[model samples]
Target chain A: MSKPVIAIDMGGTKIKIGIVQGNTVLSSDSIDADSGSGLRKRLPFIQKAVEDLLDREGISLAEITGLGMASPGIIDSIQKKILSIDKKFGDAPGIHLEEWCLQTFNLPFSIENDARSALWGEWKYGKAKNFDSAVIMTLGTGIGSAAIMDRQLLRGKHFTAGILGGHSVINYKGIHCNCGNKGCVETEASTWNLTSIARSDKNFAESPLAHAPAIDYELIFNLAQEGDAAALHIREQSVQVWSACAINLIHAYDPEILVLTGGIMASSSQIVPYIRKHIETHAWTPWGKISIEEGEFPDTAALLGIAHLVGN
Target chain B: MSKPVIAIDMGGTKIKIGIVQGNTVLSSDSIDADSGSGLRKRLPFIQKAVEDLLDREGISLAEITGLGMASPGIIDSIQKKILSIDKKFGDAPGIHLEEWCLQTFNLPFSIENDARSALWGEWKYGKAKNFDSAVIMTLGTGIGSAAIMDRQLLRGKHFTAGILGGHSVINYKGIHCNCGNKGCVETEASTWNLTSIARSDKNFAESPLAHAPAIDYELIFNLAQEGDAAALHIREQSVQVWSACAINLIHAYDPEILVLTGGIMASSSQIVPYIRKHIETHAWTPWGKISIEEGEFPDTAALLGIAHLVGN
Candidate 1:
């Protein structure tokens, strides 16, 4: 048996830490982050959270093999450093995370972008297992994506290759993205921009969707189910954008299977089939059809992936 | 000294064959291909052409290392066979190219998609020679692309990953592509579809562009320079489409340099600057800016690339 591993998923609003061995989580904890102050101010809090979890589990640092971190930004895995954070944790790139780990735990550490880590986790232990090539799209506040090709995670020259699938332009003349690109899939359909996209529709003021307490995919889906015309139109438009994104990813990565995850997949029953139909109709795959499926292990995927990274 | 290699670039309208020694072409020949008759019908003609070229160069079968072929469409390089041809040569994929080469000359052979082969040629001997990681976009009748990452050509699981950059959707609601995808950069901006795109412009009928004898980028560019309003609008739209394609490639491959080539680049003075400016503004390269430049050796890139492939 190998020593247990410590895994950290540093998300935008919350930090999830786990003490894991193989597929089992021995102890886990979560804490809300001060998103306004950024990661530098929250590092000590994260350290305390990890230490507390280890103590509660009756485990010591000596028994821990290493730590694995999954962060939401460009990560240089080889350097165990965050290369850049996209507006979320502004100060993260300035901190030497590897040095912090070395001085605190006296153990080796590995880190990867959260989405890529989730892909690794899924490929190693969940839905993507047994597949040599696959792509995963996490549909949430913004779309996040990662691709695995021929069993190798495609970290390009600048560590920006596979992680930017969400930024691919689906509508050249559409709105601008914070990432500097225009008409990105995220700008068209992601949760962060959903309200703007919905309100921009000419029928919003006259539709039932305007009266909803909060605008979200869940509400839109329910409204669409109830036969709200504007809701149906918005749902169809969002689905088309998502489907276009799926086909773009299919063309770009040439994956055998595409795994869809994240918050919006609460409507996967509808989104999955819709994307599958679009890919079937639009994508030019000569070998055979690419399989589209919902991802398993959404919350724990990055944790599991980090554990694998540290353990290996 | 290495033995000279026979390189063949099987293009849509013409076949270019060459006797190459390293970076230098000792002798070369060209013949118009009967594109209507298909590749299988022209195999004998191609073989005879190669034989005649070798004879003219006073080279025997034993003196030549091997034959390297650069063909359009999906190619199984390991098998040395064309996997699928889009429309140019319908019967190409059915022929056993390697077996034919072996039977004819008893020599080892290698083949690659023309775009990929051209990329290899550029990386090995042309404008992209200095860059370890780069992408090449050949913009002509249609857009074609290939990428090299971390010094290795990116041939994905299905052999379609990096080569489908042109087919990426730029306008989801735009026109349909023959490849089944809608709003592809190729469909929106390529020469094969340019006339249709121009014809669809709202002001095309009112502008001088409608009276032009032929509809092509060259004519449109000349008209735009001469202050034709519709031509200028179309030119701007095409530039934006091409620029969007550039950003998409940069996001997909994460290369240090992007080489632009093909007949369309005859207007490199305008196209190059437009794409460069767009990438500089739109692409998110945290490490550094990606360099965009024109490709060298437009006509003989694949020949040199194939020579390098077979010689090695």
Candidate 2:
């Protein structure tokens, strides 16, 4: 059997740590992040969670091949370090993650951006296996994307190439993005901006969405199904924004297949067909049509991707 | 001295054939293209033009290392054939260009999309020579773009990856493009659509632009310089479209430098500063700022690029 590897996925609100063997998670644990204090303050808790997982699984540190970490922001995978943390973990770039791994477990370590890690996971062990070129767009709080071309991950000059699809301007003059760009796809149709977009509709007050306790895609989609006019408008607009984003990504990275993942994929039945039909009708792919599909692993994808990266 | 290579650049209105040594054009000839006749029908004329150039320069076919051709379409460089021709030379894909080279000149041949060829030329010999990662945006009748990542031309699953930056949707709800996508940067701000965009302005009827001999950037820029209200509005809108396109390209392909080419760079004095300011303020490049510059070669870029490809 292949040796087990320690995998960590650092997300905005939670951190998941696990002992992974091939595609199986032998043991795992999750902890809420200290959002106020940032990633640096939460390091000890993460380490303890990993230790507890191993102890519960009766696994020795010596049995682990290596440690793999997936984090939000730009990651210099070649150097095994986080290059930037954006706003999620402000102190992450200052942390010597590889050195910490060497000191703690005496194991080799690898790190990558969470989005790219998910892509690697999908490409190596999930829906995108056997495809030489593929792109994965995670439509959640923001649209996170990653691309693999010619069987190699596209890490651009600054390690920001495939991860910025959300920030790609879909409506160039429409709205302002927190990233400082105007009309980014994220600004137009992400969970972070969904409420504002819903509220902006003049008919929002007349729809069931305005009466909902909390506004989200689930509520909007539910209301739209119930024949709410404003809900339907917002749903259609969101689909168009997402479809435009899909087509933009298709044009940007000429991939053979596009895997749609993220919190929003719970409605993949509606989202997948919309984007597929848009690409089929609009994309100028003379070679052939691109395959659009749902992602295989959702919650554990980055963890699995970390396992693949470390194993490789 | 190295043996010369024959380079051919097939444009919409003209065909240029040249014998090249390194960065220098040893000898060259240009002939007007019969736009009504397809590329297959014009094969004899192209061959005769090449033969005339070789004879006039007193060079034998045996002295040439190989033949390299650049055409305005989706070129399958590996197979040395055009994949799609858009409207120009609509029957180009039916021609077996490599077979024709073998039958006529008995030489190895390679073909590339004109945009990619220009990028290679710039990367190998022009402003982007030392940069392993760069993007070139050609702003002409339409916005054409190509990218070089890690020193390799980024040809995606299909041969369309780095060459479709122009078609990337910038305004998801704005206008329908001929390519079938809505609100592409090309549709928003290219020469082909400039008149319609200008006419859509309410003040256009009262502006000096309403009486121009032809509606092109040259006329609009001139009027904008003279403080024409409608011309100035169009100029600002075009710049925004172009700047948005620049940001989208930067986000899509993380390059160290962006080289702006094509006919519109004639107004680089204004275009360069606007895009530079936009990128400096908006692009999330943690490594550093990306340098924006005008293309070194305008008219002869693809010809020079073909020379580099065949020589290498």
Q: In model 2, which runs have C-alpha deviations exceeding 4 angstroms?
A: A34-36, A103-106, A211-213, B34-36
Residue by residue across B1-312, what tens digits does model 1's lDDT show? 678998999876688989888888888888886776888778788788889988998999889899999887878788777876767778888888898889987888999878888898899988898787999998887788899988888878878878888899999998999788899999999887888888898989997767877688898888888888888898899999989888888988899999998778888887888889989999989999888888888888889888888887
How well does candidate 1 score on lDDT at residue A244? Answer: 81
Model 2 over residues B196-311: C-alpha lDDT tens digits?
Answer: 99899888999877887779998888889999899898889899989989998899999999999988889888789999999999887889989898888887788889888887
- Model 1 error, position B128 (Å): 1.5
Q: Could you list the chain B TM-scores for each candidate?
A: 0.93, 0.93
Worst 10 residues of 1 chain B by lDDT: B79-88
Real A-B contacts recovered, model 1: 0.82
DockQ of each: 0.81, 0.83
RMSD of each: 2.0, 2.0
TM-score of each: 0.95, 0.95
CA lDDT scores, all candidates in order = 0.86, 0.87
Error of 1 at A140 (Å): 1.1
